[model samples]
Target: MDLIAKNLSYKPTDQFHLNDVSFNFKNGNLYTILGRTLSGKTTLLKTIAGLLTPDSGEIDFDGKDFLRTPVWERNVAMVYQQFINYPHLNVFENVAFPLKQRKMETNVINEKVIDALKSVGLSGYENRKIQELSGGQQQRVSLARSLVKNAKILLLDEPLVNLDYKLREQLREEFKNLFSKGLADETILIYSTTDPRETMELNGEVIVLDEGKVLQVGPAKEIFENPNSLKVAEISNDPPMNIINAEILESEVSFEGISINAPKHFNNINNKSFKIGLRSSDIILNEKGYEFEVELAEISGSETLLHLKKGNTKLIMSIEEVMNFKIHDKVKINFKIEKAYAFNSNGDLASSPFRSKNG
Candidate 1:
């Protein structure tokens, strides 16, 4: 099923929950709403699921008005962070509940119920009570419930939030592989979360939300590599992109009071003022690099986050290997000039006026 949201906004009392937002998703693709907490990610999902009606705007599904349709008749299945389960019901009953409510045949219900359980790797535990399962297992049971309904449109609101790291990763792979094997391009998967693992690795189209506004939306790779706004870059990455205030000159760019060859993107620009963004992975520290004072170094597994302070900019550098840089370490940091991006004071990307193939 195709989904389209046009200029959706929600305001309750004095709070502006959602701003004017618009986007469309075709069948057979996974789309993720990515933003920081309180960024209206969940609100957008709820609005789409018909749980919260938009104060203004329209929702269309395959050219039909879905906002006006009854929730049950919308054929949209949702698995939310706060799972819905009948505390009084057993696992079997809970999984079969939706089908039973629809009054499907006994044979059909049994077949679909078992199939759903197997799909979620929750086979053979159907006889147990809902409270007997662990948090992850219970979440799987909830997923099975969504699958059993055979709804073409699926909405997942941080469904893995309650699960531990290992279970979450494993389950993510399971879902991805299942859908890939099926290759159903007609089934739309809309997941709302702040996890880069969910949006970036899954190749989902990311819709960046801030407060109630849809700041940006695009393919995962494009958006991550070149975020239009500083807020977008900060909210979209694990280590966040490094931003340095660099003064543009006739021959090159200046950072930390050091100058480098004119970058390919700026090979022709005569502008004297601009800001440059360098991803953590793009920063290289060497004796011959640009000198910036390191204020802090954070070690995370194999990567080290170097928070450097130079002049007025605090640039974040993502180093691949763990380094023993102390606080206030004076070091030279270099970047892949061609791969770097330049943004103006207004947070908009500005390509080098000088045309270069490297950019």
Candidate 2:
């Protein structure tokens, strides 16, 4: 059965939290809602879970009206970013809470809780107290609790967001393993995250949200490579794509007084002013290129992100190695003309490097 949400809108105040959102979520598929804070990712999830009602929308699940159903009867499970568990109850009891609330048989509850715990790699942590476990383990407990329900719809709202970096990486791999191994074969899983990297790692159907609106939805890679608009490109990218105003004249593209031979991807387009979108990785350091002063340099992990400026243009380049550079340091950089994306003046994508034709 598929879950269909049509024209969902919820405006509690002056702004719309879910502005005309609509999508069909199929079973046995993982969908990621990618957005920043207050982008309505949580609002959409809560509305689907029946935790919050929308001001206007139609929710259909298995050919029935889902919005009409009570939250307790919706047969959905949600795992929050924070570790949520009963402080007085141990792992076993915490996971068994849902089944107990349903007054399920003792034997069935025991079997289900054990299976859920095993699925989350916490098979032996049943008797451990909540306070006695680490943050990751506690999250596992929360995950096991959600998994125990075996709900038709499973919503994970940034479940690993609070964990340490190494732990988050470990759990992310584990999650991919779990989801790919048919553990949720009968459920529709919806995960939300602000991390573009995390969304790419999951490699699922991606729904890009921005300011309470659904900007674009497609395969994670497609959305990454061919963001429909400027907003989608910015939100779907980790460091946000660098945008620069440029003009196309015959076979050349000019920006900030610098001109380069336009790639074949933009050949069909008319000579006009367009916005160029380039990923940080697409810009490279070259000794024979234009000189730009370093505005800022940030070291993250094993790479260095250099922010540079030349004339009126600014760009960020992602260097593969861990290098040190000071502010105002002069560096020569070149654009990978073949990897540039062209956006119309209205911010809609006019051409992409991955696409053969221009709009």
Candidate 3:
């Protein structure tokens, strides 16, 4: 079974919530919708779940017209970013709600509920009340509820987004394990998140959205290594990929007052002005490198992100370890030229180091 959306467009007002979005989602694959807030990730998921009607589009599932189907009959389950559960119901009741609604026998409901709870590591907490559980546990209950249905379409809209960082990380790992074990092999799993790292961890097919428009779609590694455009690179990265104005002249790539030999990937290209893209991790502190002033230093977990500036160029450097640095501190840094990317003046990717030379 496959879910095919053709030219989906939803515009309640003047802004297009989903602008000409189209994709063929195959069964049994996990697809991550990665974008910033207000980027139509949630809107797209809601549309698929039959929660939002697109202004103009055709949805077909398993060769049947999906848009004409009512939300209740879609057999699609969605877990929202916020924990959604019936406060009056216990964990078991919440998980069994869908099966019970179908008027299944008690034995089948009990069996399915227990298995779903066990899959999400809440086997012994079946008797616990919704209010008694922590945020992570509550979210697990929501997931268990969806799992019990065994629906053909499973949509998770930032399900782990409201939890603490540590708990989010923990649940992310569990999600990977659960999905990797064929738990929902017959289901189409579509997860939406604004976190690039989370998308990277999932390591699934990625759809990069921005402002209600589709930017790029590919494997997570492909999108990460070779973003189709400048916006894709920025949205696919946490601190955003560092971009600087540069050009190729003769056999050298020059930017600001610095110049480096053009990478072989850019060989045979005509001399012209373009833009250079560099990941934060590709720029490192080097004593014998170009000088830049530290504008801001942020410490996140075990790493340090240093925002440096020199003349008209500014860059963010991701250091592997934590290091303290004050603003206005002079630091020399070097770029990993081989790991750099090139984009045309119009913001389209021209060359990627990950590809073969001149590819």
What candidate 2 gets wrong by more than 4 Å, as runs, is 356-359
| Superposition-based RMSD of candidate 1 using all C-alpha atoms, in angstroms | 3.0
Tens-place lDDT per residue, model 3, 1-359, is 99999999999988989999999899999999999999999999999988889999899999889999999888899999999999999999999988888999999999999999999999899899999999999999999999999899999999988899899999999999999999768999999999999999999999999888999999999999889899999999988999988888887889878998888888755578878889999998899999999999999889999999999999999998989999999999988988888888778888889873332
Please give the lDDT score for candidate 1. Answer: 0.79
Task: Give residue 218's lDDT in candidate 1 (0 to 100).
Answer: 93
Question: Against the true structure, whose lDDT is highest?
Answer: 2
- Among residues 3 or more apart in sequence or in different chains, the pairs in candidate 2 whose N, CA or C atoms overlap within 3 Å are none
Which scores higher on lDDT, 2 or 3? Answer: 2
User: Candidate 2: how large is its RMSD?
Assistant: 1.2
Q: Roughly what TM-score does model 2 have, to 2 decimal places?
A: 0.97
Query: All predictions: root-mean-square deviation over Cα?
Result: 3.0, 1.2, 1.3
Candidate 3: lDDT of 204?
91
Q: What is the clash tally of candidate 1? A: 6
Candidate 3's error at 156, in angstroms?
0.5
C-alpha-based local distance difference test score of model 3: 0.91
Question: CA shift at 287, candidate 3, in angstroms?
Answer: 0.5
